[model samples]
Target: MKLSKNFTNPLAANNPVIVQILGICSALAVTVKLEPALVMGLSVTFVTAFSNLIMSLLRNGLPSRIRIIVQLVVIATLVIVVDQFLRAYMYDVSKQLSVYVGLIITNCIVMGRVEAFALGNKPWDSFVDGVANGIGYALILVIVAFFRELFGSGTLFGFDVLARFGYTNNALMLFPPMALIIIGCIIWVHRSINKDLQEK
Candidate 1:
């Protein structure tokens, strides 16, 4: 049951993005298009899962004073790997993502999980928590990107989805503030459904 909660909680009830408001910067920067948002989400998921696993494995022996430094090293190394991989095979998307890929190292969601859950949990449990939180973040990115790309550019993954139907692209949707607006709407809907999250 605990493992189930570890894996399931972040999907909605305890999402890193909307609920905890952890990684909103990337959501705003990359959600301008679906492809980059998808790539960014996957990149974060990989880094989070492995960083948590590594940190959890090392937690017992890690000196408390240097733990934050060590966590940054681990996360940075993983982010570099993802960045290089994207540059190699997905150059266009990598270019679109720009420095935001490297910025994942500083992402609150990644380091927060390492400090909060991975340090205390078993390796397997920590890995589950990381994956869950990463996916939760990714899910929001995808939703926001979907609406942004559809209305902002009248395209999804560069395909003309609505242009033929007399849809005039809304330039405003492509901006970062639009992403925040979409996220706000999502939070409102989420809280309405999950009354437990609502303030008394």
Candidate 2:
């Protein structure tokens, strides 16, 4: 189904995090916990999906010379809507997310999707592309968050899921450096398994 492509394609092959590295900056910043990471992922998905949809509908009317400007406007407008919604509903998460939510306006993943696919494709196809890439970006962030949060905080979603064990929480995992290391380790494992992705 068309919707399947929109949701699944970004998980691999066209992954925004590993393949394109479009949104790694935020991935490193807010992924210190699974909760914030999940919030960021969901926010990006919403922004990308709607931006793609609207841009596709307007693509036909956009002037070639000012297409980039139009895309920026659409993406910024949707991001603000998303930001305001988050602030109203999840003030804590919004505070934790802070500048990153606003920074979503500059996230290469959203802008890239709008320009590369939405600007040139049908509305439906563009919507699918946005969802797909958002999934891809979220997938990596989730993995990174899972490891960082687990070892860093000794829990997921801040739940005492592993309280039974004598896990000594490594406070270092709570920092950005820990996230960088976790991501590097994941990329190493990924490259090892997919030999073709490694240097010959």
The true-structure Cα RMSD of candidate 1 reads 0.6
Tens digit per residue, CA lDDT, model 2, 109-142: 9988888888778888888888778877777888
lDDT (Cα atoms) of all candidates against the true structure:
0.96, 0.85
Deviation of model 1 at 140, angstroms: 0.2
TM per candidate: 0.99, 0.92
What lDDT score goes with residue 170 in model 1?
A: 99
Residue-level lDDT of model 1, residues 76-156, one tens digit each, is 999999999999999999999999999999899999999999999999999999999899999999999999999999999
Model 1 residue pairs with clashes = none
Model 2 misplaced regions, further than 4 Å: 1-7
Off by over 4 Å in 1: none
